[model samples]
Target chain A: MNDTTPNSYRTGPDERGRFGIFGGRFVSETLMPLILDLEAEYEKAKTDPGFWAEMDDLWTHYVGRPSPLYYAERLTEELGGAKIYMKRDELNHTGAHKINNVLGQILLARRMGKTRIIAETGAGQHGVATATVCARFGLECIVFMGATDVERQKPNVFRMKLLGAKVVPVTSGRATLKDAMNEALRDWVTNVENTFYCIGTVAGPHPYPAMVRDFQSIIGKETRAQMMEREGRLPDTLVACIGGGSNAMGLFHPFLDDPEVRIIGVEAGGHGVDDRMEHAASLTGGRPGVLHGNRTYLLQDADGQILEGHSISAGLDYPGIGPEHSWLHDMGRVEYVSVTDDEALAAFQLSCRTEGIIPALEPSHALAHVAKLAPTLPRENLLVMNMCGRGDKDIFTVAEALGSKI
Target chain B: MSRIDAKFAALKAEGKAAFVSFVMAGDPDYETSLAIVKGLPAAGVDVIELGMPFTDPMADGPAIQLAGQRALAGGMTLGRVLEMVRSFRVDDQTTPIILMGYYNPIYSMGVERFVAAAKDAGVDGLIVVDLPPEEDDELCLPANAAGLNFIRLATPTTDDTRLPAVARNTSGFVYYVSITGITGAASASAARVAPEVDRVRKATGLPVCVGFGVKTPEASAEIAGVADGVVVGSAIIERIAAGEDTASVLAFVKSLTEAAHGA
Candidate 1:
């Protein structure tokens, strides 16, 4: 809206919802009208002071805004290089940063007079957050989870159920996140009249990737002011793990114009980024293609059939990343890297032992990269990573990985 | 003239709406699927819509989705689909064949090469579900340039304001999805479809074919009475998925085709 908007970072997508050719509304004719309506409504809501006031009230009172940027002093002292700071979004009401976007979307859903809410989940943190919001708002909620994910993330499934949400187990094609996403899209098209699809991450068509990022960008906004107030300068490097890339986008968006600040995104490298073992490292192993809704880097084969991405963490097992991340990767604004399951497991344990904080496996992937990058940089260089989620749901997974009975 | 254009013109001359049958290129296995495809035109089907099976068919319901999974499990790649068409073209040259599916496989095949090969293989048209008019420059325009009909879908949600854009650059026939849902999710009603079909015909001169929910002979007849053509996909796919033989499937297709022609 202003000419002073930075040329390097904030400007994107243009009017057609493209993030420099990465993001566009790639849905079917059945969904085209609904997507267009959503775009218009979101645009109107963006300019409405009433909408912002309602969102702020909920963020402050219900969802708990301004999650702390806690300094991991013990871990920093042990790493002996860059000073480590963790944006503790895990302390959010639903135990993850997912609530920040969920709260905003559900509020918008209420504003739009939608009666039903639908979502697709991988690790189920998002499902819980959505269920929590729908329960608070008294709207009907349905969450589609891959059958494999349902079996693994039992606690999150139960939490969603407790919040009065129906968790539908999707038993199609690898029975994972992508299939669940497909089922959610089907649901949205089928019930586009009264249903609002609250996408868990920033990967769907047009307005979703942009809208979800704006809602989640509170992470970066708070981190910016907090770092400025506490340390008098921005952190040199920002790190977050990407799986459909909401948390990473939330943490990276505000710092995009800060030319001096470097942003790094960590991806799940299941066993390794090799031909034999499967991984969800879309940027490193995948090429640009269309899936779900947006045109982005997808883990598709020679024939363009989507391949199931394997990851120790269910949350990071998606075959694609957000379209914005693809644009950033192409623009060379943010550095993207991958960490293996073993490395993430090590980081999960180390953080629990050193900092007394148990991070979800998704962010453990980011922590794994931090372990490597922190030691390489100077001790004074401020390195901040988003502790996007808590690890309670991952205990069974961790136990199995460690070859121990839970 | 292109087979699609000729077929529609013939239907228009005869005062009859066309009956289009859709089947996955390789369901159960490639050979049986090929047998079923070859038997379709003789079974009174006016047009053949062959599915290009993708790993993720987001817009399809259970019957079509399961059919695709079986096809993919049986090793039905894009190459195999084209092979099926080439083999079919050797015998039947008059019946229009449309390859319907998502865009990823075609994108991976290199659009120019895929369009050229589809044309060479006797494919008459395409109905890539995920590619809208906004993305026409990506595949639709090129496919059209290669002399292939790039058919577009019009839905219940395609308002008058949006109908023109959906109609632009569309050829062969306009696919009017009768429901606001995935394929085979709901039963289509002629009462709700007739006005929409009339509206779409006004937007584009291309003959509008109604699809997505027309499952039975009666439903086909009812829809055929109101539209230029009726496309039945999941119902035919349901028979194939139920282990029906080629003869039985052809009989079922004949019944629906007769219903449309008689209507």
Candidate 2:
């Protein structure tokens, strides 16, 4: 991997959608033409003023953009260190940052004249977000969830059903996010005619990883403007949880050229990184390999078979991170860290107690890292953590984790 | 010349479309799968697509996926798959065998070394579903260099701009996915497949063989009328997965091949 200069991070996935040696379209021939078509449509859509116009309009009116960058004053005082701020994307419609990318991709799907929408979701946050847009557009929507996730994340499943989208439970492999993604890819390859795969993160084959990153970059773009308007400069550090690294890419892409700002990505260290089969910390615990299209950091056995990743946060239970995250980690531009489930649970409760805000377990991993990083920094230094999702869907899981019956 | 080239040439002289049969290696067990494969040519199968089962098969439907699971459960490693091919080669040498699966196992085995071992195993071609033309440098080029034909799949969506790319590094024959979906997800219509076969045939001189969604003898006959070869995978594997003996499975395959040849 070459050194990432200040200006280099903005332009990723060259023509063939490669980030260094990662992020190419590693798919079967059936899906290759579809991926290429998506690439062409995205290329035109990125430049089309009308496309952005519709997307911005939806962002402001429907999906709720410019999610507040709130000063976590009480939490900062409790931590007693660098002033902490939260990019409260949980305040967005559908209650998470997921809607940002969902809205953008749905609009593109509509532009491409695709009438059907399908997606894979783990925590069901992305599923609910996709179902919301499909409902708005009256497109036929199907969300594939792991059978295990369907059982555990029941509230979001109900929400998807209420929104009139069919949630298919994928029973293959380990039956989690990775299996759900595999099933969704199968669906995409099978129904390439009218179906548009609304991938929930900055992963998958080409155009998806880069395109989703561009859509979700609204978080970083908004943070840049919001922070400047408030603090007159970029934050000292930017932090976001990395499942497939969509939220982190969204929060970090804009600041990559900002030399003074440090970027940190927190991966779900379920149990611990040393617990080989029990963590989703791909960058921290895995070697580079291929899965779900892109060649990225993957948790696999010696025979190259993908291992099921365990995480308390379903959203972070994928075996691989995005290819761009792999590139960034290799380039030493973004510091990748892992926070265990116990640490995340502690941070989850800490946020609710101190800031009166309930954070989803995914971002609680990021918060756990922030808690450690913030205290050591000088008091004047600024820190921004992406509170990417709300905790409403996680109440049951949290209760169970805390040993309280909900 | 590669066995695939010679087989196509022989089929052309005989005025018949090639009949290709697919079965997951080590399905039910290595010995059964080897028996099924070794019996294919005599059963009228022109070429054999031996499935190298992997942990994740994103392009296959339920039947093929289950077959892969059974194969993996039967201890079907890459070495075991090569062993199956080598065992098949011990008795027969004319029929072309293509190792078909995702790229991970081959990659895990190291690309050049895997290609060398595959050639040594009498493997004639490869159909790695995940390694597209964009990733030719990964395995396609190495396999081709090692005297193994790297067959590429041309789908309905491969437009004029993309066809050239998909056709560039392609050898052996172009495997035309009859439907726009995964293997065995939907029935293929000859009416929809005929023009696609024509389109791909125009761009590349390599024989176009159609697969995916082809199950019945009638479907194979219909597809055979339009394309150079008709490939049947999930149907054959379904019979094996149902615990059909080798003779019964070979008889069923002979019926499909006769129907194709009759076309």
Candidate 3:
């Protein structure tokens, strides 16, 4: 609470759990009392210090926090722009930073005495993370996925099944992540007594946007220390891709106070902005509306109906975004941009071909922006990119691009 | 003529069930929707239920969701929606219009503000999808203060213990979700709802209106055997979404009048 100690590094969630205009607890009357109870429990848990110590222990021993900030010297030399350093979240357990947030939420879910966990998944990364935690914690877990995603991401579906998560195939209109989200919400509404929905993104009503962001803050906290050790200062820009924006928010939170570090979020520009197939860029082409219990920007038609989003990357395809993201984009603090599927694929191939590292398509959009923006900056300048996830699950996509028989 | 009590008093004397029809206000476009709202009273639609479109319409099946999609596609907004409800009052003053949807939008709009605007626009009741009997304190109590009914849905999910609680909290009419699913899912059977209506009647003396899956005149007639009112949505929205003119649709609605009266 002291003035000298920076506000962002205080290591506790806000009194009401907000990040600028992004987080709050706007929920149903039935759920409001529960969220209030959660807020009180979380507040008390924070004061316990033991809970903080346990989170630290998991982050260090089981979940692996303070992941290395590796200098991409080879790629940095090739790109010939500013020095590039990658926050190795891909090296974390479960092959992405998604596990960190899931673990935290699962712990909290247990604390709230909820025994069942239900989630919605698009590309299946978050599903895998949720399934892993449910197995670890011995909780019954159900996952709702659009039928289309289940077909495209078979490996992840199997991974979830192996982890004992029952994946429910959603048959709603368009049969995608949006439908799965609707299905999960319907399940929550019908089973509010004992079931808890573990949302895969930093969106939905109030406390979720805030709670998920707080869990993801570990990414930013680790990168800050790692950067200070090697460069003796913060990077000039921080870039991350947004799909309901959990990964991006995770990498942006601890750095919120670093006024000098420019933050950029890349949204999926599917085919092109003009064609519906070309843009799932809610930030670029969305309006404010209420969905899944909170007010946020959504890609809706003229009559105010929510539209189905399209993207080459199944993971980034969504019609609406997190409410906090709508707030953040409006605040003008973080620069929001868009990248095409071709651009992301090209960047994915380049990073793999040049540096022996393949990135998930979601973060590749961010890398594509880095590919375009890094070389233009002065050599003395530094860039920090959250290499959120690996592309082990994208072999089918890679094969198709390579023109190989699957 | 002024509110639910007066309307029900008149209906009590006449011994008639309220003919409720659900429509997404501003479907396809604002003008067409306004026309339909104006035409409902003449068509014998006793209570007009206007659904406010939300992106994740969990309680709606494909047909009505598409109707909602068409309205949203036509550039209908919350502000325009309010204007449309206000527009209904311009032509008709006696009929009750209930604004129904998932709770997200109103919660986002600030409950007090939305309830006040809905009241000012002459809306009489609300059916919030995710709202249950346990959560009636927020929308139900506030809406009651504004003289609006916070109608509750009793589905197959409601057992004997919950049925009475739901009936106690609700007003205007208790909406019986005829099935466990969303609107427009299946054809309703009288067998499915007869016992439900009997249970709800024993639970409370409030007027009970049956909805969800009532797609045909025959279905309405079947529901009329037990419930006080019959609610229809998808069959009408399908007409609107398919580009049917209101005059023709209303003519079609007029045919269903015999179904409610069983004559």
Candidate 4:
């Protein structure tokens, strides 16, 4: 063990890409050099003012930056306790917070002279976002999605096709997010000459978790500033749903050093985080194991064979959580919880009926936890939940789940 | 010296390149898989690469991936894989057995415990595809400390500047991945792999074994001409997937080994 723990949680992932033995570059030798090159380029871009200048311009003009942090009056009134607010990242160009990280990675890819882009998606939100950006840059794009996801998320598949991306349906493993990522890694290893793998979540190898977190920190940064302007103080609590935990990491990373602010990450509880292994809550139900190039909490059998995670929301069906989330969970810096599918469904309906806003089932999990936790807190306690995605793409699934045919 | 080193030295003395064959333990079933492994040495294999099946084999193509699935479906586990090695050791002591796969199973089993178990089970070396030199401390160093060779792979993407790090702390012979892609995706051209094998051998001062996409006896011979050893995995697993009996699989491996040894 290193024995030396840093005082600040923000300055993690020491030079070796490790977040306290959680995240490291555990990739095949075939992609090591490329990962190193990317790390080097990202290091240079971190200090280059011109790089941030381009990112700022795109985030402002193209992505519609400063996504509103709106006061959820109806939700707060219904909960009968802590005031509620929703960070409106679902209003971004691609209708999800995934675009924020996609833009940053695409810009870096262009700087690296990579012309082909590859990505893996679960619910197709990230695919749509990546395809949209690739279309804007006129770069070749390919998205790997599980066949199961392709069948369910046909609309996003069509959208990606319309955006000129080739979507390959992976049929391996449980045919979900994990398999899609495997296929994408295979593509990346094969096409290392000119390909750039734009990972969707805060998972995968080292720089990716850190890079995606840095890009998505815009959510929390905006939330911090907006809360100050609206409430005259930082929110008492922060909540976000975690599949690969990108959105939660985004909203929580900027507030990690704020000891007064309580952080919570809600993971998908498919049936329940029980012995049956039906949930996507890695931190709550799983143990530390290496997969997809990093060591993190994963749903695996005793033999270390990764188990297929189930969730009503396709976006939250991954079997692993991001490394930083694992590190934070170990350090007790953040509280990790799980909400069942039924609870998330109830929250989804509640959000539509009360707030006049339809939330993707991924965030509905967070909303479910919020509904439970809000009533227990005092009236003056302020709570902020990330409305990370819109439910426009999930209407059919929601309709089917609610026993109403679309 | 380890069995791997002794086997390589014996091959060098015989003026022959070593032929390494890979098969997933418990593929189809335990008994048949053990039968195939036991038949490897008599079929002229100098080294054996026993695949510890994983759920997601990101570096593998369809053949090896299917083999892993079949093994997993047949109830293969880290313990069972180690048990298979122990069973193989009861009869064969001269042939080097190297366990190859992802890191999770061993990690789940606990690295130190897994290393000790692997050494006790007659596992002479390890070739974890995902563990680059950057993660040597995780398993490589421990395996090395436990007297097991932790082999490292040098790929086409592993350029001259990065060769030193890959070669450092590498105890066994270096594995030179002949292609930039996954296993069994494309055929490796000797013309393309010869210079790379030479580069890795020079950097590591270890015998170089070329693998990935070496499918046929002819290709095996071609690769063997340029490196000290040639590894054929997917091709052997393909025969197993095709439901060829142990004798047929052993015959197929014999042809490749004969070609490699002849070269």
Top model number, lDDT:
4
Per-residue lDDT over B165-243 for candidate 3, one digit per residue giving the tens place of the 0 to 100 score? 7777677777887775567866568887888887876787777788888888888878877787899999888888778
Model 1 chain B: worst 10 consecutive residues (lDDT sum): B179-188
- Scoring model 3 with DockQ, what do you get? 0.20
Which sequence of candidate numbers ranks them by lDDT, best first? Answer: 4, 1, 2, 3
* lDDT digits (tens) for residues A17-87 of candidate 4: 88887999999999999999999999999999999999999999999998999999999999999999999
How well is each residue in A1-406 modelled by candidate 3, as lDDT tens digits?
1224333432333444443433444343334444556666666765777777877888888877778888888888888897888888988888888888888778878878899999999999999999998998899999999999999999999999999999999887678998998888767655666787888888865567777887898898888888888888888999999878988888887776678889999999888766454589887887665566555677766544567777778888988777666766776667899998889999898889877888888888998999999989989888888889999998798678667877
Q: lDDT per residue, candidate 1, A1-406, as tens digits?
A: 1224346778776787888778888889889888888888999998999988988888888878889999999999888899999999999898899999998898888878899999999999999999999999899999999999999889999999999999999998889999999999999989989999999899989899999999999999999999999899999999999999999999999999988999999999999998763999999989988898888999988888899999999999999999999988888889999999999999999999999999999999999999999999998899999999999999999999899996
Instruction: Say what the interface RMSD of candidate 3 is.
Output: 5.5
* TM-score on alpha carbons, each prediction: 0.98, 0.96, 0.76, 0.99
Q: What is the C-alpha RMSD of each candidate to the true structure, in Å?
A: 2.3, 1.9, 6.3, 1.1
- Which scores higher on TM-score, 3 or 4? 4
In model 2, pairs of residues that clash are A190-B181
Q: Give the residue spans of candidate 2 off by over 4 A.
A: A3-7
In model 1, residue pairs whose N, Cα or C atoms come closer than 3 Å (at least 3 residues apart or on different chains), thus clashing, are A13-A18
Candidate 1 TM-score versus the reference: 0.98
Q: Enumerate the candidates' DockQ scores in order.
A: 0.83, 0.72, 0.20, 0.88
